[model samples]
Target: MQAIIFANRTGNELAPLEQYYCSALLPVGNKAVIEYTLEDIVTSGITKVKIIISSQAQEIEQLLGDGERWGLDIDYFLSKPEEKTAAVLDRLSLSMTDSIIIVRGDIFRSPCIANFIDFSKQFSNEFVQAKMANQNACMLLLPAALSYLDGIDWPLTHDYDSNSVVTLILHGRCHMIDSFQSYMNANLNLARNDIPSLTPMERSFTSANPEQDFYVGAKTHTGDLSLQNAWGIIGENCRIDPNVVMKNAIIIGNDTLIDKGSTLENCLILPHTYVGEGLEVNNSILCKKLLISLNTEGHIEIDDQALIGPSEHQASTSSTDRNLSTRFFILMLLIASLPFCPLLAFYALIRVMFFKLETKPLIQEMINDNLGRSLVTYSFNVPTRLLSLLPQLFLVVTGQLALFGAPAQIRYATGRNKQRLGVFGPVQLLLDEDAPEEERMLLMLEFDNTHTSTKYLSLLWRSLRIPRLLGAERKKQNMTH
Candidate 1:
């Protein structure tokens, strides 16, 4: 008989992290999250397995790929967010068999095969539905009276009280882990040290000697090391920088980096991070959007998803008010006094010797065109112009000024105010000039001070206090532009 493994993972509450790991890398002890469910399906001696994925589709693709790892001939089906339940099942039934085992990916399970086999065999009717005691544990038993479900509409009137026929509710077990905290607790109980010696679920696919393929996926670095589990899949796209040390950690997903001279122990590092050099990290799940530290002695929900920025500006910003305020004040002071610093003196000497600060010849020639017009030059010696840039350079180095932003132009006395001492140069200033007077002043100030750094910091701060500040402002700007 043929069996179809139906896996559905969709979570709205798990917004940021779910966008990456999804159902792919939930590790119980040394077992990958998807591995446990897949193992249950294939080991039940099912010939064909159909694994479906919702969000984190990329992660599902990377880890499972073509499903050659599962030993069974695996097929995949995708569903749109707007697609309804009936549509999902209809697509699956078109080319597949009637006997189907639907598994939820976000749910993890213990090493149990008998329970699932019983559900499939006894309930091998037109439809079978599985339920956990709650939603935090593996699926133990399901109602097998789905044959009667074929003719009935799944959506019924409010007055109809339908009772399920076969209900097996285990007293002590749950069906799913709804949050990251529960997931971490489940991992602590399931991972074992003897895993490398045992065959992993993926290895069950290889036709070669299974004993040779017994391997574990664990995080490794070239530096001094301390690892809890000596085996596990170090995702192919992960960057294990040199001089980094790791112990008892599993990494899932891609576009992640563990920077140099860092130590990680019993943690999950999700994708896209610098991991900051020379840090002591332990017992945490570093999702790009949130950091879940299972090592905490008490139950603390770190639901700060705002740490992960929306779109491409994730890395270049910080929202912590204390940090932002400190950086701004310190950078402002440093820049204001930087022109006279000793570093500028050394560079000024070089500039004078190399003639780099000499006014361009084109500017000298342009003086004729400005005969009647006011020609203003902040006349400074070659050495002085070189030194004049020191303040801005200091601001940039101090993390106040962005690498590239509109340079604050000196207000030229000419009626043509080409040079102004505001953050927004010509482009933004011109836009602001067209706005209503009161609104223009307010917006101009906002636009000027809203440097690349400020733009990111402001959005991050707003994302926490307000719902859609960054996305809304960005959309508005795009529309106007």
Candidate 2:
């Protein structure tokens, strides 16, 4: 028998989620929601299958590329939006084929396809339906039962079944993402392993002290957190602060960051998101700048990424907030700042020669320079940040750095090198050289992710307030010491 997966549903109800990915592409645990369906097909030993796709169809095709990774021969068909399953089968000339196992790949399904197939193979003249404990979301059809296609629906709504239809309420599970609430519940349940044998990927379960049920993916940086009847699943390459408090079932997606002093409970943080410090997030879905709170039934778009935002790569996407106007304005700022180079150079020379300042700062340190800038370090005997930036004005003239681009500190910071180095970024102003590595990283990430022309202009103006921000930081460091 062959398998057919109708994955064309756009999942309009999954609003904010659709902003990033279609519902089928949404990550659950560590895999996309459709991956479970594909795995089930492979488990059933179905070799040839057809996937119907629409609305970001390229991404689905890219993800499921020919199904060779799963050892299945697959064909892709781009169907029109909201096309009925029966109409698609007709278009593909697959209606008269032998018994076909139809799978809806747009939602979460974890049925034992082989078991269902074995149980229903005996009836060649009747429609067979398989159900989880609560709902009938998957079904199969016999060769003789192909005539019943007119009454069935795209999703497995079995309203057309009559007395001849056999319904098996098996142990399989199907979690619907009809709304944001159900989507959150499904993810939380999966994180807790509430659905048996349904989790696609396996993470290392650690029992280090209070972190009893902590399931973490590979190469993730995290520390132990006390849990009370709670579990946490962190995906690959995530940086979770050591002091983070995670309660209840939580799912942090791949390449995510959870900054220090934050509290996460019953939440699903999407991939490439940066959760800032001291954020007490509970029962919410975070996708870049969009925060969907369960209680409010609405989303809040945060303008300041220093609080919460996307990661470096995700930053360059929609949340980057960089456009032609902003770039043009930055160009104007660069042109405007050029005239000051002579005076700034004179001041730097004076400071170096007399004010007990040394200009032998680092000019050769490498921190992920995507710009291919020439090596020029700017270190000083004393920490004269104002003087240090003078030499970098030359870099700005040559486009080595944005007028207000995100920059890495030449001396102490180990912030992610992927962030662009700017002449003035929040990380440079808000953090002292003695601040914790986590704090620096979080600030730089926020700046790199959401830096716009306006933010750049503000930071330029805020140069006057550097004494205050840095003084405050120094005072905090002094108190800590």
Candidate 3:
């Protein structure tokens, strides 16, 4: 028997999800939507199949290459948006004796195809439609009836006429998910074991507690949370805080972090998402870029990444350690600052005498101490700005401030706006003080959250341009005043 899986559904209803992945690739549990259909076909003893895909075809092709993993010979065909479903099938050109099975990609079902085939052989119908609650489940087509569907429009509804249409009522699980609410419902049902198991990819990282209906993927860390009566599913490489309370939730996708003291109930937290601490997320889908509230049937795209941002892996301590590169860069700045250091010291001495210069605890030092205590501080003067920053080079050399890192913050800086101390930073060099406060804060948070070696080099280059930036800032300030 041959099979044709139509994965050509344009996931307009999926909205923000379609922006990232095709609906066929949407995670239903630990697996994609198409995986369940493939498993059904494989178990039915069909070894050859053709997948018709349109959006993100390359990604899907890469994901299920040749289908050897499932012991099946699979071929992929690209379908156009204008092409009818019947036209797509006509291109295959099956023989008159061939019995083919056609499965829709967007739906999730675990039907006994073998039994359907047996029924089809015994029955005299040319087209057999499987129905669940009076809705189309799937269809079986014989070769003799193939010519009648040539050039017909897609989405063969119940109104489609056939010489002999036999309806097979589905007794088991069948769910058609065309919207976000439907998708969420499907996942919740699956988590509650309302339907048959959707076979997950064979990976060593997956673990399932059948008793508690809890499924966890690999490389995931869960803190001390009670899972006695709750059904929870966590994806790979995720971090769950110890104070979290989760009940009947499906947290799929990788590298997600649930902050401390958060309560999640029947929520779908997408991959690469960061849930801030102490927020109650219930009946919602939290993608890295969007927050979908199932309760209100509405969604909002998240522009500020700090609130519900993308997942970021913490840099290893060794990578962020004061290495030779940092030391060399600090040394270069120190040498350059030598010419102005004595002058700045005299200026600072005079300012101290007049009570203009004051000692402030380094922000980095305060963060390290975690005591949240700091001393007095000298304000940056317009004419002596570069000279004043020159003193920080000594701190850079002493391994106190990184040459290129997050901007320095006061001891009272807390919440999302808190930043580490650096001698010079991307924000001070790139953003004018006149920039929107929210934009500046978000930018700094993003910089601190990202882990890249190139940022250090970029900061070094920006340091050279600092005098120009400072001059511009002063000019802007003077103009404003």
| TM-score, predicted candidate 2 vs. hidden true structure | 0.63
As a TM-score, model 1 comes out at 0.43
Evaluated at residue 474, the lDDT of candidate 3 is 61
TM-score of each: 0.43, 0.63, 0.61
Span of ten consecutive residues with least summed lDDT in model 3 = 410-419
Cα distance off (Å), candidate 3, residue 300: 0.9
lDDT of candidate model 2 versus the reference: 0.69
Runs in model 1 deviating more than 4 A are 6-8, 24-32, 56-65, 82-85, 93-97, 119-164, 168-177, 192-219, 222-266, 271-273, 280-283, 288-481
lDDT of 2 by residue, 235-332 (tens): 89899888888777678888898888999878889888998889989889998778898887688888777767886533434433454445566567
Q: Which portions of model 2 miss their true places by more than 4 Å?
A: 95-97, 150-158, 207-212, 226-229, 313-481
Using lDDT, rank the candidates from best to worst: 2, 3, 1
**Tens-digit per-residue lDDT, 374-457, candidate 1:** 222222122222223334434344443343333333222222222223222322223221333444333434444444756645
Q: Is candidate 2 or candidate 3 better by TM-score?
A: 2
Q: Please provide, for model 3 over 341-452, each residue's C-alpha lDDT reduced to its tens digit, 9 standing for 90 to 100.
A: 5566566556565765454221123333222534222333323333345556676676666665555552222322223566566555565545555555555655654568
Shift in Å, residue 110, candidate 2: 2.3
Best by TM-score: 2
